[model samples]
Target: MTARTLVMLAVLAIAAGTGWLSRGWFEDAQRLTALEAAQAAASQALARESVIAGVVEARLATLDTHQRVIDRGVIREIQKPIYRRVCLEPDAVRLLNDAAAGRAPDPADAADPLPDDAAAVE
Candidate 1:
C-alpha cells in the first residue's frame, strides 16, 4: 500500500482501540455510582433504626422508674410480720376428720418464705 494509506489505517486502528477501552471506563463509572447510592441508603436506614431504638430504651427506663415507685409504696404499707394460720370451716373439718385421724399436713400447703434465688438452690 501507499505511505498515506498506511498512516490512515494506523490512525483508524488507534482510534478504534481507544474507543473500546473508554467504553469499559464508562461502565465502571456507572457501577460506582450505583454502589454509592446503595451505601447511602443503607447508612440512612441504620441511622433511623438507631434513633428508634434510643426512643424505645428511654420509654422503657421511664416505665421501670414508675414501677419501682409503685412497688415501694405497697411495701411501705405492710407493717405486720409474716405469719401463717390455717382455720377450716365446719364442713371442711368434718371431711378432714373422716379422711384421716392423724396425718402430716400436705407439703404443697407450706408457705415458701425464701427469696427466689434461695428457693431455686433447694
Candidate 2:
C-alpha cells in the first residue's frame, strides 16, 4: 500500500475508536435527562398532594369552629331563667330521655297533662 493510503486508514481507525468510546458518554447524558424529568414529575405530584391535605385540614378546622359555636349557643339557651324554673313530669321526663337516647317516644306520653304543682311553678 502507498503511504497516503496507510495514513488514511490510520485516520479512519482513530475516528472509529473515538466514536466507540464516546457512545457511553452520550448514553449517560440521555439517562441523566430522563432521571431529571422523572424527579420533576414526582415533585409536582408531591406538591399537589400537599395542597389537597392543606385544604382538608382547613375544612376540618372550619367544622370544628362551627361545632364550638353551636355548642356554646345550646349551653346559653339551656341556662336561661325560664328553662331553669321549669319542671318536667315523669312521663315528659321519660319521653325526653327516650328522645335523647335516639328511641321513638310514645305519642300518648306527649299528650299527658302536667301536674298541678308543676303548673303552679310556671
Candidate 3:
C-alpha cells in the first residue's frame, strides 16, 4: 500500500474508535439529565403536599382548642347546684313552654305568686 493511503486509513480508524468510545458517555449524560428533571418534579410535588399537611394540622389544632373550651364550659355548668321544684307553678310551666318554643316569656309570668311550699325549699 502507498504511505498516503495507509495514513488516511489510520486517521479514519482513530476517528471510528473515538466515536465508539464516546457513545457510552453521551448516553450516560442523557440519562443523568432525565433523572434530574424527574427529581425536580418530585421535589415540587412534595413541597405542595407538605403545605397541605401543615394546613390540615393547623385546622385540627383549632378544632381541638374549641373542643377543650366547650368541655370546660360543660364541666362548669354540671358542677353548679341544681334546684328541683317540688311543684310546677302554672305560670312557670307556661313560661318554660314559651321559652322552649322560641317565644319571649310574658312579663306578667314573673309577677305571678309561687306556692307557700316553694319558698320553704329556698
Q: For residue 37, what is the lDDT in candidate 1?
A: 100
Segments of candidate 3 deviating more than 4 angstroms: 65-122
Error of 3 at 7 (Å): 1.3
Model 2 TM-score on a 0 to 1 scale? 0.44
Q: Itemize residue pairs with steric clashes in candidate 3.
A: none
Model 1 lDDT at residue 116: 63
lDDT of 3: 0.82
Model 2, range 4-77, lDDT digits (tens) per residue?
Answer: 99999999999999998899889999999999999999999999999999999989888743333334444433
Query: Which scores greater on TM-score, model 2 or model 3?
Result: 3
Per-residue lDDT, model 3, residue 58, is: 89
Number of clashes found in candidate 3: 0
TM-score result, candidate 3 = 0.47
Estimate, for each residue in 37-109, the C-alpha lDDT of model 3 and write its tens digit.
9999999999999999999998988873333333444444444223455377667778889989999976665
lDDT of 1 by residue, 1-122 (tens): 99999999999999999999999999999999999999999999999999999999989888743333334444455444332213554445554765697765554544543466875754
Q: After superposition on all CA atoms, what RMSD does each candidate show versus the true structure?
A: 20.1, 21.1, 23.6
Q: Rate the local accuracy (lDDT) of all candidates.
A: 0.75, 0.82, 0.82
lDDT: the better of candidates 1 and 2: 2
Clashing pairs in 1: none
Sorted on lDDT, highest at the top, how do the candidates line up? 3, 2, 1
